[model samples]
Target: MALLDADARHPITLPDGTLYRDTVYLKNVIDHPRIKVGDFSYYTHSGKPEDTAAILAPYLGHSVRERLVIGKFVQIARGSYFITSSANHPMTGFTTYPFRIFKPETFGYKDLPVRDTVVEHDVWIGHNAAIMPGVRIGTGAIVAAASVVARDVPPYAVVGGNPASLIRMRYSDDIISELLSIAWWDWSLDKIEANLDALTLGDMEALRRA
Candidate 1:
């Protein structure tokens, strides 16, 4: 059997052979029009599989202008959720109160500028993290547990806190550039499996060779 199955909704299996229902491949489970998820991107949540999209991104409604773009191999821990553009109240007005929402006919703040929320490949978002609207979390970034990320996180950075700040970069700029150029995440599963040592170990030479 293959190590990974993209088609499986419940992808993880315990040592005793029971399917781990809490984790699901986001692409397979999510059917929202405004959200785009790549292969192997998984989210751990207690909600039903059918409600995975809503659970992960509660504010991203079907007709919303903004999008939630998540790339391949993203690891989203339990209790993490996205606050998309639709959730924002009108900040331009004198007050933040959404008076238009009281009436169904005039229920939208369409004039507000909307921006898409993007999470790039191989990003790890920890438990109870809140990703703010329009934030772009770069590839290989690590968002610490219980963080409220209001700003963009650079690639390979470790960020944490209420308004998440950069803790440190995982690698030097040169190495990060090299890895981004390599883009191992784009490789086929067979190729990736063959170069597991290079991927798991910090072996740049081996990775280049692979």
Candidate 2:
């Protein structure tokens, strides 16, 4: 069966004939008020009827008031949701009721904090993960499936579990620093393809040489 309707607007199909839902579409994302998804990064469906292209922003937990800036080469698996800043209701007060939301003229939306959620390059967000508001996921970090990330993740770290804690670093500090310095993702397509072997398996020295 066809995954998406033939009349689907601005459908993005991969080389393998996989059609990504509307949330991952660059054109649609660029038009979004608070979400900025970079090149080569796309969202997948979780095989639920609620995971439709019609309401991609809500499905991904995006807020119209807060910013969600995702960098290049990010691998975001299916069912990954970003809990944006707008999700947080004012709790410092006696009641959690947001009267300001209803009375824009009297209180305005200034009471709501808008934290920018930043996901750096080459980060791998596994399936069913929920990234909390204001969290900055560093470059090359891996968020394991079903994890609930509530804090900032350092570069090259692997995190998992509820209130996700760092499990381990992907590489030694020196290697990670070197990789960051190289910034391979910024390279041209042809150049990157040429160094694919070194990037995937060989040492940093090999990548540098390439």
For residues 1-210, what per-residue lDDT tens digits would candidate 2 score against the true structure?
433322333356778987554335332334555667666665666443344322334522333556778887787777777877665778787998867767647543455676788999989999889888889999999999999999999999999999899899989999899889999988776777777789888567789786
lDDT of 1 by residue, 106-170 (tens): 88788889999999999999999999999999999999999999999999999999999999999
**Top candidate by TM-score:** 1
Scored against the true structure, residue 41 in model 1 reaches a CA lDDT of: 97
Model 2 regions more than 4 Å off: 1-30, 46-65, 104-108
Query: In candidate 1, how many Å is residue 39 off?
Result: 0.4
Q: Report lDDT (CA) for all predictions.
A: 0.95, 0.73
Clashing pairs in 1: none
Lowest summed lDDT across 10 adjacent residues in model 2 is found at 1-10
- Scored by lDDT, model 2 comes in at 0.73
